[model samples]
Target: MPFMEFVNFYLMPGIVLGSIYALGAVGITLVFGILRFAHLAHGDLATLGAFAALGVVTIFGVSPWVALPVAMVACAFMAIGIDKLFYDYLSERPKIIVVMSSLGIALMLRAVVQVVWGVDTETYTRGIVRPDDYWGIRIRDREIYTIIAMFLIVGVLWAFLQKTKWGKAMRAMSDNPDLALLSGVDNRKITMLTWGIVGVLCAASGFFLGINTELKPLMGWTMLLPMFAAAILGGVGRVEGAVIGGLIVGIAEETSVLFIPGEYKAAMAFAILLLILLVRPTGLLKGKVL
Candidate 1:
């Protein structure tokens, strides 16, 4: 293939895919770091966000761009409610129990999507969206929006974690929850805040996915493995690491078509996940290992 062809076909898509995955992975990392369990329902939450945005677009006749924030805020609230209703009660139980509950929650979310949306494949705005060529590299408008939005959101999130008071509390809780609680940090508030952020991130991820591709009830479930792979590859609980890992996995999946069939492209993530587990369990940044 021509070098430019590679850039247009592989590298660009990889970055976009990575950006979407990064949104979800960052949430997964935060959950792992703070709650100390894998949130298996995260992708389903993304699906819910996507479907919620679709509803706004359909009912309000508004552009999906306008509905994005609406869906995010709604999803954030729902996530908080879920935390209070299901996860909070299990707090006294082993963390593993919560993980299983998360899996159950994932199924419930998917069922809701299927019953409401009827498992039909949907899109925000459908048609042939041709890409504009920029110096021999073709790129779609949605692609640009997805990448830019991902950068803006993740950058703002990083800033929040670095410069804000709640961000510090979150970090402290992730590092040592017992000490943080002893220091007078309100554990309940921090937990709620984390879920809120995770819920918003899911909306972002879902919106981008709907924009870049078609929406399906199962799409979010399909993303679960890749999101987890990104989190693991990036290093658990390290925000920057999750971003880097997401990009790597996205690029790897897109480029894998050069040597392997497209059907197995997802295997790339699995390979990376297993490889990281074997060689460097602590991850690239020495993040906490499972």
Candidate 2:
């Protein structure tokens, strides 16, 4: 294949897909780092967010872009509610309990989505959109938006973590919860705030994924493996590492179709996950070990 063709068909799609995965992985990493549990319901939460946006679009008759923030806010509240109702009580128990509860939550959320949105596939807009050619490369406006939005969201998060008092408090809790409590950091507020951020990231990721392709009841569930792989690959606690890992996984999955059957592309994430766990458990950025 030609260079531009390869770039257009494989590399560009991979980058866009990677951006979506990066958003979810960042949320996953944050939860692992601070909350100290694997949120098995994350992907389903993302599905809820996407459907939330669809609701806004269908009910309010607004552009999908306008619905983005609405969906984010809705998901934020939902995430907090879930924590308060389910995860909060299990805080003192073994982490495995919380993880298993999350799996239950995942099933509940998926069921809700199916009931509300039905099992039909959906799109933000009707009709097919053609890719615009730039030089020899072809890309869509939504693809560009997905990449830009991912960076903008992550950049703002990075700044908040580095500069703001609350952000620092969150980091402190992640590093040493007892020490942070001794320092008078409000643990409950920080936990709420982290879930809010994670919710927004989840919504953004799902919205982008829906816009780029199509939204189905199982779309986010299908992405769970890749998103988890990206988080583990990048290193459990490192934001930057998650982004890099997402890109690598996305590119590898897309490129794998060239050498292997397309149906086997999903296995690439499993392979990467296994490889990372065995070779360097600390991750590329030397993050905290699981």
**How many clashes in candidate 1?**
0
Candidate 2 lDDT tens digits, 50-154: 999999999999999999999999999999999999999999999999999999999999999999989999999998889999998899999999999999999
Tens-digit lDDT track of model 1 for 175-235:
8999999999899999999999999999899889988998999888888888988998888
| Estimated TM-score for each candidate | 0.99, 0.99
Off by over 4 Å in 1: none
- Which residue pairs come into collision in candidate 1? none
lDDT of 1 at 165: 92
lDDT of 2 at 265: 97
Deviation of model 1 at 171, angstroms: 0.4
Clashes per prediction? 0, 0
